[model samples]
Target: MSPILLTEDLTMTYHVGKVDVHALRGVNLSVAPGEFVSIMGPSGCGKSTLLHILGGLLKPTSGRVIVDGEDLAAVGDAQRTDIRRRKIGFVFQRFNLFPTLTADGNLRLAEHIHGNHRSKAELAELRREVLGLLGLEKKLHHKPLELSGGEQQRVAIARAVINRPAIILADEPTGNLDSENSEIVLDMLVRLNSQFRQTIVMITHNPEAAAIAERIVEMRDGRIIRESQPDRGAKRG
Candidate 1:
């Protein structure tokens, strides 16, 4: 099977004042369908930058990004946005939920924005199934403020996956949670990957979170340094 996501010699440079900052340099990576991969690096090492480029949020200075077989560098802004909406789901450290919206409301908004063309009944069914998978069915009416950090993040995950996008890009998903909550979130992610065969690429600083993925990619100085399978014998956080 072809990879769901691929980046070829990806490079990003920002012109800040007199100096050019290279956020990514000659980075090549691929994530196959139904695969879970984690990227780990210290601050300013370009993991997040790579994630954004993969998600089509930022156009790299040079090189190609292919998502679900479409070359992102060849597309215009509108086409890129359309591809992102149809093919990629994103989870961030911040839940980014609206305070006034209930959990179900937040998910419904995503469906609307994603232009899910299913009938109302089908859409409702999809919402329920996704919420149930994330263990948030009972809290559907609760707003973000009424839920715990873990619950909020779960709802965020549900919202991201409800449309069954081709791939999920998660950036520091457990960064804001306590250890207990982080563990819960990580387990939910693992369950999602294992049960649904969701293609996932996560950027994390926590080794424990990275371990949950099938493969761990280490990045440094704007390039991938190494990639390896997680050691099952190693202790998890």
Candidate 2:
């Protein structure tokens, strides 16, 4: 099977005054469908920049990004936005939920924006399943401000998966929570991946967090330096 996400010699550069800051240098990555991969790096290592480029939020300065068959680097702004909406779901350190919308409402808004062909009843069932898997079934009526940090992040995760996008891009998903809540959120992510075969590419600074993935990729100074699999007992064929 072809890789759902692919990057070939991906590079990004920023001009600061007279200096050229290299954010990425010749990054080549491939993620199989239904696989979970984690990226780890120190600050300014270019992991975040790679994620942004993969998500189509930033155009690469050179090379190609092929997500679910579409070349993001070659697309125009509108086409890139469309592909992002159709194939990618993003989770960040900050829970970017709507302040005024309840948990369910936020999910519904995402569903509306994606505008899929799922029937109303099917959509509702999917939403309920995603929320239930994330342990947000009871918190659906709560708004962002009313929920705990973990609860809000769970809601964000649910919103991201409600439409069953081809891939999820998570950047430091547990960065804001305490240890207990971070564990809870990570467990929920594991459950989602195992049950739904959701493909995920997560960028994290925590080694423990990166260990949960099927494969761990380490980066430094704008390049991938190492790759390994965590000793989490059994591998998921």
Residue pairs that clash (backbone atoms under 3 angstroms), model 1:
none
- The 0-to-1 C-alpha lDDT of every candidate, in the order given, reads 0.90, 0.91
Task: Give the TM-scores of the predictions, in the order they appear.
Answer: 0.96, 0.96
User: What is the C-alpha lDDT profile of model 2 across 1-237, one tens digit per residue?
Assistant: 999999999999988999999999999999999999999999999999999999999999999999999999998999999999998899999999999999989998999999899898998889878877887778889899999999999999988899998789999999999999998988877877889888999998898888889999999999999999898764333
Q: Where's the lowest-lDDT run of ten residues in candidate 1? A: 228-237
lDDT of model 1 at residue 235?
Answer: 37
User: Number of clashes in every candidate structure?
Assistant: 0, 0
Tens-place lDDT digits, model 1, residues 106-195:
988999899977898888787777777788878999999999999999999998899988788999999999999998888888877877
Off by over 4 Å in 1: 233-237
